[model samples]
Target: MSTNTPAPVGSSGKGASLARMGVFTLAMINVSAIVSLRGLPAEATYGLSSAFYYIFAAIFFLIPVSLVAAELTTGWPQKGGVFRWVGEAFGTRLGFLAIWLQWIESTIWFPTVLTFAAVSLAFIGPDQRWDEAVSANKWYVLAIVLAVYWSATLLNFKGMRTSAGITKWGTMIGTVIPGALLIVFGLIYWGSGNKVDINMAPGNFFPDLTNFNNIVLAASIFLFYAGMEMSAVHVKDVKNPGRNYPMAILIASLITVGIFVLGTLAIGYIIPEAQINLVQSLLIAFDKFFTIFHITWLGPVMAVCLACGVLAQVVAWVGGPSKGLLQVGYAGYLPRAMQKTNKKGVQTGILFIQGGIVTILSVMFVIMPSVQSAYQIISQLTIILYLIMYMLMFAAGIALRHKEPNVPRTFRIPGGKHFGMWLVAGVGLLGSVIAFLFSFVPPDQISVGSPTLYVVILLLGAVIFAGIPFLIYAMKKPSWKNTDSANEFEPFNWELKKTNTETSAPAPEQQH
Candidate 1:
């Protein structure tokens, strides 16, 4: 056999050195770009106040989840990521289910987010009746929806490099840039003697936790922040997993909070709560702002950016979750058909299945009387699925501490083992349960189906969809396990010790 020259050895501990990352970049990527969209007309539709209630709602639920996710991700960096972590914590079945929920939710989520982009695209002018076109001929929206879905699907076929490029630029240009401009536009209007009558009086500013609607709204917001660990899968790929992970979360969190607060304030300044259209609300704000300011020219430009952002968001969603699901598939949780991968390592089969499911869900636009109704209906299923995943993930966080007590972790929750892990896990558990309970109550405003129909759909969704994994688990056997891939990721504790030796960090006890 012809032998290539032996590669030179890297410096002592040089391989481990490659694992460090700065906090800011990690935070920027982990922080959400989509939070502002939910805060605008969406929160108003749920009857939340702009100030006290909405932000309080987020702090109690969203913020904690982000922190918890950051801690777990840094602690456990694996190829399967969440699946591996949860599997080690719980069992193979529950882990499969966790990844399943994450994967399925994204597919269901496609139609809803795409509709947001389509509505924003309609903002070009009074002349372009995109929304009217969608309503008048359902197939028009269906076609565009399919176009977006397939385009996103094919983009991923080139592998994650294409997806990453989209996510990075899409987030900056599509999310941050547009969000900042909206705030600036609102501030300028306020400076020009245009007063927006916002109901920020004490009572209105605080969200009524006692109110069923507001409580459910908070639950919904909790799910909106559910994907904090979505980027956790990338930890191993980063230059330095441990340091970069937490930093990235922190950076992303700051960006997310700024956008939510400022963007909502902008919307409130431009349009009153009652007049906000849950369906086409962003446009309403832009329309009103443009009309008063006479910068009508920027309307379409913003719409284009928003549309491109939505497209990027869709691509991100499409690639991320399906890749996780593909992991689940390789674990024998899914049929071998789904395990097919191309030379470049893209999972073409799963992408097709995801596209099909999205298409089926998209047909809801035709059946539901209003597009907003379709959004609400499809969204309920997504929330329910997400809550189930949160429950498993939270429980896994606690279980991992006990089951793999000696596992090497870059960061562990601060409190003593008995208290810290339980406390953090408890918060996630409680929030998830509360979200699950409230998901059944149809929103007071949007009506996709009757209250009875909502309850039936909720039960049907929880039982049928959640049951899919059990069937797969029942079919599992020793042969189902792939011997080659069975080797779990083991942190190089010796190398870790040498690296931390300079800092005098204590050696961690090795787990079996």
Candidate 2:
């Protein structure tokens, strides 16, 4: 059976032992990697019905991703995460596409998220009008987005130890503590016979599924669950990955789902449906929730915590995919120049490239009609790119079950092997395809510029970004491989088999 012998180039030493992460630490990393509070207010528009959408998405997308990823990571805990998994199933060609999509989607998404973070920063003041005006200023938004993103990238460059430390505390203070507090305050408000805006009647618990626009909004919840697989890249750094990693995924999924579901309900309980503006409603809800407890002073404090949570989440993202690309770089997929790593084994080169992409995309704030327009347009592309990657991941999961049946796995999908793999990965793949389709239909609420132009941009972005990896693969040369001491990678099952099919010869010399 094949084994995932941990590599030395993980965090700080020449041994995997250097970066020993416990279940709690790994779980926190997973949590911070995916959760963001920006979309809760949008979901709050559905009132108590939002819970139905959250639970639906968790079943079809979130849980499937967690299960498939657990099986894939435990069976093949290589450095490249999705790159390694897909490559094993198909070939290096598509695998590079998978990893690049992971990188580029996050690249495209930086602005949307940082814009939210910028708004969070804007709210760190007493006056709502001032906060609204500051958030709308192009210059203020651009500066905050660049500054915060670059700071997170730089923090990740310090390697896993420093990054993980900040992630743990940041997620706790920013997300978990604040989320718990909001839910608690919401309950208090409801208990005190406060005027709740949403009807708690059982009949209002489900959204109108016949409405296409509602599905468009609900489909976005899929992307909220997107980054779980990225955390698989860190399995090697964890303690007893076979045992602890799967458990961590379950723990993180629960925390994230709870925050998203209950947090949205908190907002719905406080704010009237007619007044819910996606941009300001969350802060507005927080303010009213604070007022209920007679602690309106804590409004700005909550804003700061939300910003910290975003920064922590960005740090998690900044590390995972870039490191995965670095692994593929050593295998000759990326240019040798981009394969460099620091003393702490962080991929500084790729981070710079990633930062450069963000810098360019951030310029759209000034180029577009407004920051909101830029975010609305660019975010569609982000969803498209990421759903494509997810589709590939789900396909790879099912393929690997048959293609490498003998490979030892610490965790497998429930039920039997083949049937379980088909069921879980099939559900994930179907969900991704559905989300990908729903992404094109522009929401009825927002004036996303010209709808035709918006759809054109999304289609064109998908084609262009998806094609770049293929171009890279075609242009690759043996000389592109990094020969440095830390660049060693294991041969895939398919690569080994192809080698044996050729002339009977000694194995290819280990390429580092």
**Which prediction has the highest lDDT against the true structure?**
2
lDDT values for all models: 0.66, 0.79
Clash pairs, model 2 backbone: none
Q: For model 1, name the residue pairs that clash.
A: 19-240, 20-240, 23-247, 26-248, 27-247, 27-248, 27-251, 27-252, 31-252, 53-207
RMSD in order of candidates: 8.7, 5.7
Off by over 4 Å in 1: 1-20, 32-39, 46-48, 128-137, 162-164, 191-193, 232-254, 477-512
Model 2 lDDT per residue over 98-194, tens place: 9999888877887877787888889999997888889888899899999988998888878777777666677677766777887788878788888
Q: What's the TM-score of each model vs. the native?
A: 0.83, 0.87
Question: Which segments of model 2 are wrong by more than 4 Å?
Answer: 1-33, 155-164, 231-255, 342-345, 505-512
**lDDT (C-alpha) at residue 376 in model 2:** 71
**Could you give candidate 1's per-residue lDDT for residues 1-512 as a string of tens digits?**
00000111122344452454346645554554335363366655433264443455455555556555656676666556567667766766777788887788878878877777766665655554554454335565667787888898998898877777676666666666777777788678767877665654556656666778766644566654666555453454456454555456656655665666567677767766666656577766776677677877777787777777778777767776787677667656677777677888888888988899899889988887777777777777888887888788788788777766777665566688758778867876886788789888877756556778767867887787788878877887655444454433343333356578867966689999
